[model samples]
Target: MAIKYIPYFKDAIQGQALLDNFVRTKRILKYADNNEVKERIERGLPLYETEVTEIVGKESDNLVIRGECISACAYLKENNIKVDLVYIDPPFASGADYAKTVYIRRNPRIEETIKKAEEKLEIEDLKTFEEKMYGDIWNKEAYLNWMYENLMAIKSIMSEIASIYVHLDWHICHYVKILMDEIFGEDNFKNEIIWHYSWGSRIETQWNKKHDTLYMYSKSEKFYFNANEVLEERIISEKTKNRLKYKGAMITDRNKGRGDQEKALPTDVWYIATINGMAMEKVDYSTQKPEALLERIIKASSNKNMIVADFFGGSGVTAKVANDLGRKFIHCDIGINSIETTRDRLKETGASFKIMDIKDGVNLYRNPIQTMDKIKSLIPGLKNEDSVSEFWEGAINDSKLGLVPVYVPNLMDSSTKLLDIVLINKVINLAIPELPDEIKKVIIYYIDIIDKKEINDFIKENLGREIEIELRDLKEILSETVVDDVLEYRILNNEIVIDSFVSDRIIRKINEYNEKMKAQFIVKGGKTKFIEISEEGLELIEMVSLDCTSDKGIWHSDEEIKINKLGYTIENGIKTKKFWDGKIKFLKRPLRIKIRNISGDEIIFNVI
Candidate 1:
């Protein structure tokens, strides 16, 4: 069976943080109007309504629940977005410290000095690197803990016909294997794919570790398996000489035989070619596996359009490759630089995707529940009311469920008012308006608690049979929605997350897409030796042109030019035009001409 997953951490969390939760937790709770809750209602224990979400196209049911895996798994189990496939890469636990950022000095003499400064780290980025990437989040213990928990949660989501792949190095692979076996059943253990590469770095004291392990596990005997999706050829060269014989004399001639030494089934111990120099892709996100390496894994496991997720999406290399191969993907990283890396890579491909952040929950989309519910409420017959707990709980699950409680700090006699909530079996049922209001100033409410007994008793006392009574605390979960009077838009935690959907504007034309309505940029190349190209050449152009003025410290110099943070390169040999504003400057045929240095390095340009 195909796996389905839903984000349910919000449900499993203790307490109702809303106003409606107080009224309902103290009273009887009813299931909201939705097909998923109809069965629960019949069971006399209706689950909280799943929030209807803002959706564009009718996307597939495949889900990618975004959370630190551990908390995420418990939440998924509480809800129902079960998963089918699991793959991840964890810390090897090798003694080497993995900082949030890395600083590389050109010479070995400065290594100790750099390490000393790094040890006495003040601001995050400076300590990590000369070329700092993402040090802030990379060094957080919280992120590492989240990774382990996700593995735990993933097990519950996996179906009987599901399998998981955990990638690890010598440091943590063994421990992760144990963890996987414990999470997934030990009986369902699959192969340990040893990805062997021929070359890279080696140690003089010992043999260099050139391969990594991919631990595969399945829930049961049957799983989704595609036989021939592997695009990679198993053999580098034909062994015609090895075909000495097939079997007995009658089976085949001496020259033509199905040689046992010839290419056969690709073993779990795959030895693929290593990625040395610029292999097809433009940049190498260090620790990135070769395309051929991932190709074999995909071929052995899935087919096109299968939903794939990578939580530790470092450079987003795996997800990018998966996308190119026509696979749907969900990849995330807590590190800012890593996310930037993913965004840049995806932008290059022009891939359409939603940006999800943990802090804000669903970043985009306005919750249309109130508008839809208000419409239904206006109709006399359609006014089927669920208890306040049920109402708010249901709101939580709706993909379009947007509930930002207005926090009036001094609304009550004391400093503030408390909106207490009662939940039952993770579904909020009762809501009790806290310690009375000093003035009649309106206070927003949310759900907080859902004790199972409280729900049962509330339902029995009110409606006879046991019904769901969910409690919620408004302050605990909900935030104030900033309704922009001028913009007619809502603010999410102070961020002006532009909602393109249902916007009043009729997009007569997409202003951003019009190439003519552009900020003209000036690009030039400095003198060079031969028509050669080094990464330095590209860096110089970018430093001077695209780099921001405030961040000029990041800019460096090359042989031909000195670059600035704004990506404006100063050609050292020949001076450039001072007032290059709006002129029909010609490259003579952009990308065709070779702007070379004395040492044979060349540079290319993409005008836009």
Candidate 2:
């Protein structure tokens, strides 16, 4: 077949005879959904419910898991994050189309025979069919821009005493070298390290040449470089420490001489290609660079705790080596297939990884519900009374308070209601028992009868801003009990968290309260701990109760919940039942109150 054409980076690998046309093995599609495959996610097995977690065994040295190389560079530039050394073996952008099959849901290329219509190519979904191929980039400007944007981001994230290595061939190597000069500064330009690897080639016209260039640059005039870190010096038999000691004494050693140190600090040309695919060190990426290549550059340049960033993280060779060597990494790639492949490659090697798995065309899989489930798991259980007492609460005395699901991205939306709340899936808050279980977000609505006269009186007296019921988030009314007759929120995390097990109405109420009071709750999940959700819409604060006394009971005044000290100082004042005028007094200061629950079996608040 004719070689596929790439306009931009063609020259880089064009003249170069393809070395590893099929050297690399098949890498795991980390993103592909394989029903048979099970991953050991960082989050421990659920006691009962499933939860999402960050990558397992990640290095603290790395910044964000999904960090971009350019993003890492930004941190280096801004001095926000740190980078001591950087290495990138960008795609040669080989225009020639390499061959491979395609799969979805981890299925083999069942549709390989079918031709993928050209129109399907433009669409975002990458399920089209055609023989897999590799090609160089067409637009040189676009490629440069793409490389430049990331380089700038990387520049920002590097340190002053850092170094960078750009590995390439003849094609765009010089062009990229120029770009590097612009990015790192010509003054700090180090050496163009030449790597010489020889494979048998018989060229009828000209002498066969074999080597790749590694351009090293630094941030400042000074950077870290350890001589010991360079490849171990080649030693002759006599040069061996033991042999040298007895060299003159033994005839065998006497003739042996010290191996000449290929002096002059490994000049422009380095003649060595450590290992190719046939070697056991082989990995899954088609462009899986040898670890020795990266180790040489990394060891020669930076020390421990330094950061590394790579943009074209094909197969994540740089990240894997850097991670194993005790350095942090910011790895990025635009290909969707490569994201998962890179992630798994780094992971299986036991090198900690903060992976940025990016893929194109396929839908962006948003996995953020972990945070909600964590919060839900911490809820306190409700205590049910004996059969006789349960009757009083379940039937006679307790009133039905409804609960519902709510989906509110923003509380400022006009479609929300005072009573309607969205129901978040149990997996997010309360764990749900279902496969492919998604958080069931819905708006809640409930209506209940109360003391009409007292309600009206209180509404009139307080001069409370009457909520525009119709204007607020209102939903269709429903009458039923899927779980119970009434809904209530049990205490959890020292706050009134949504008792998803309680009333669906309460869920809606919490959601409505979030809308009305602008309470913050977790939205995006993907957490394993108590991380704060700022856009949570409403603040989940601890409540402060007061020991104020009233004619009928102890009273506390509070418009919002507060975490208060003992004896309930009015940090957040205690609230009580309002009677005479119906106008509720929003107390700002401590008020004198009395207790009425003589039995102390319950706590009561009566506002005077």
Candidate 3:
């Protein structure tokens, strides 16, 4: 097949060589059922039902969907949520793991005082932990596929007169331009806006590349654009200023009136400063775009009260600017930190918005409801309906696995051992009693790679029972892995109690590395070491904020709580144990709690 357009690299694979690679990976469709999405959106049915969590305002009826952009876009399509404008600042394919620095304050103190004191603290003054926010590492083919699927999904939900602005650097903008052309049609192609900013890193080998490209595309030929609203006045011409007086009026250009000058629209090239470290709008997140940049896009493409959206909501500048410009916005992102940062930023704007999770990060493949059936098929002589029913009962109530415990039956044979048995059978629909007498050794296995200790404990608790049980992990068997990372907490008498937490995913990684390498990692040393992870997971947990009574996504009064193995308090030049084991007290009820992890992933849930 003849290639249409491909960005050639020096000494890189070219033509069919590159096309072959692209063709190898099957295209990923939007995660949402397109027909279902369309039906729901057109019918005005609620696409999301998870009690719209308002991150920071007095009940925003507006939406903030979290997950993959394709999922959010699919949901938007289902709800017929027509977006007047879409701005995406997706990964530029920059080969770097952009991380956000998280700080833990020393000395246990009151939440109110901590928030106030934190405002005055600098990045260097506080003890810090670095957590990866998002990874921008992608090969050409993977990056193209990722962008293509999202663009197609975004196109389905756009209004007839909607416009899209894709903010990207030089790295992948050209390729994405081709992708957008195929999606939006070449005729609808608009300007390749140059957002020039200073303070970019200077390199010796090449001239400073200090500008980002924003490719604007419309859904149709005639789209909404307000040039007059986004215009920049031209500076007075030297010729007009240096003109000699003729009679009553100066011998200058007759079109030099103040109002006329103001009518001059800004060019496609815009000069906006990058968000500095000390900027009030800066949320300490890397790759954060400036408000001025989004302000121009929001004002030019969308009108007041119109719906705007940003799928790749890095730092939430688009949502904040759109909300401030009197436009409703829908912000979607895969990163937990992105959601948390944007939610907090929008809270300051006091924009009422609902937070929805399309994909459960905590329950990915680990969902007990979905995985239990598949697990039953893997075990030998345990395909009975009663066994499957029993598994579900234990899983729903289990403290550690949170999965239906496998049902292991005692063997009838003398030499049959439970530990030596392999769970490798497909379903034959035969009853458990119909199985051969030699296969009576039924061993229930929990395939976990990280929760060895937790698995061992479960085994010990069930030992000396009629049925034999064995703990199996990913290392031992090829069965599916489940991560039961949950926070066990309770609220009674207006006080919050954190009983325990299971961060199995992080612990598993630590254990895996510890066995492979001789060097001892801090996390491998046990639970005493602070649990922190890259991207979004349990380790990202930093602080939990509880608002006593909040239905809207706003936190009125919050008790900031942190978990530490050892914490101290200082009073009158004497340090005392304020918290025995990161013990926190909350004098509130019907609480709305937002738990922010190290990587900025937050879960805002209520305990009423």
Candidate 4:
């Protein structure tokens, strides 16, 4: 096969032009209002509105928004939520899949069996599988377009003295650097800090790619940079110390007239180690950065109590570090896993924050990747059709309409999630024309719509082919009858005893994993042992909290217990070396009980 010579800078001019037009036009797409959002933008109205879903801890300025970065920034700008510092570790456009290791909790019921066998429960004994959080795959042009919009939105919400650090790798950082220059004026460009780490796989074909670039840009000329805050400890040579002693130099003179002689200003090239697996702060998130990395950035660019915002908060390290440094934070991400991880991590710090979700239609599942995986099973009669084009998800065998091709939007790509005039036109002008003649009808699933009537009218007027167009609300389909975990609990005296807990999702995942493993073992001619679950199924529960304060509305974890992967118990944010005993004691009469599964699914039951 011959190699295609596609230049790395292929979309430079086109991407710049697209960003320029976006800056000049100022058109926005608000899918939640069911109207053309550009019209609202022209009327000088907000692009998107955000609604607070849950208020965590006490009322404070800290925020954790579960939505797209662009929408979050737009809402922040509209609400005047400006930030002094911004650090975003976005997808690097590396064609790879990122997943979290889903580990089954230790079964306390099997303690006797484990003890009799003279074996201690280890991570290897636990049944674990990879659950994809998100995919970093992207077309170059599309990625640039998405990044441009996000960068512009971020720049809009930045304060006059604010600085942003865009974290990216070798794959797409150079391209985004150009976009950053265009969005935040080239004169405002500050530093291209190279974060050097030595904890990744080494390649023999070329030099190991171990560093990530952080492109720092300020909103204006006056940006915050306190060198003393991020000063590192300097190591003086023995020769230099001897010379200083012989010359009888003062401590201030030896330290360049500074009182602190040990600390020196950090350079643009930062050498920080990645998070270790066994580290106490490790949250098992794929792209989680170390606290030291964010500590330096947060301290140098932001002051105490100043607002720090991270739009692409992967594992909430930025938020946690910012809170530790006494800076209020706004953490935003589209993934539900990220939101839950950040929320739990922030809870450990006792920081008060409100969890907000943008009124966009993407809140159907845990995240887009899982939604896409379940989309096939959710749709009735939808099956894989190899003959159809890639644009179409699958075809359904209709009773009267014959073969109806179904077009499910790729949830990972935000561009396809909403159905508007432009997307409808693309379907009519590009996708529909390539469909087979026998396909009389097409079912298009959409997360959100601009206007159903407007889209229907556009399809009727522009579509030259005589085909029935059916637009189905994917959110409605996905919202139907979700199976929740079963919990059996009873209040005894002052303690609420959880008799048993069962997660249908966890059980299903276990069965599927065992069957796949069995097949693999059969192919390799090896003995296979299936993972067994206890009848009580108490092991599936990772956390159990009681909200004795209120039974309705916002959740307040009055008393809680979290069982870590290593069987250690964390009671009320304090980790104990002792394992969980499966008993929860409450201070007052419990009004509600919240149980979180090992995979982060939470189900709340009212005390009845």
The CA lDDT of each predicted structure is 0.37, 0.38, 0.55, 0.77
The parts of candidate 1 lying over 4 Å away from their true place are 1-67, 71-83, 98-148, 231-263, 282-284, 360-608
Query: What's the TM-score of each model vs. the native?
Result: 0.43, 0.42, 0.58, 0.88
Show the lowest summed lDDT stretch of 10 residues, model 4.
1-10
Task: List candidate 2 segments past 4 Å from native.
Answer: 1-53, 63-79, 98-134, 199-202, 237-268, 356-608
Candidates 2 and 3, the one with greater TM-score: 3
lDDT score of residue 483 within candidate 4: 86
Weakest ten-residue segment in model 3 by summed lDDT: 1-10
Expressed as tens digits, the lDDT of each residue in 30-52 for candidate 2 is: 11211111110111111111111
List candidate 4 stretches off by more than 4 Å. 1-54, 113-122, 238-263
**Top of the candidates by lDDT:** 4
Q: Could you give me the TM-score of model 3 versus the true structure?
A: 0.58
Highest-TM-score candidate: 4
Model 2 alpha-carbon miss at residue 601, Å = 58
**Candidate 2, poorest ten consecutive residues by summed lDDT:** 36-45
Those runs of model 3 whose alpha carbons end farther than 4 Å from true positions after fitting are 1-59, 109-122, 236-263, 360-542, 547-588, 591-594, 601-608
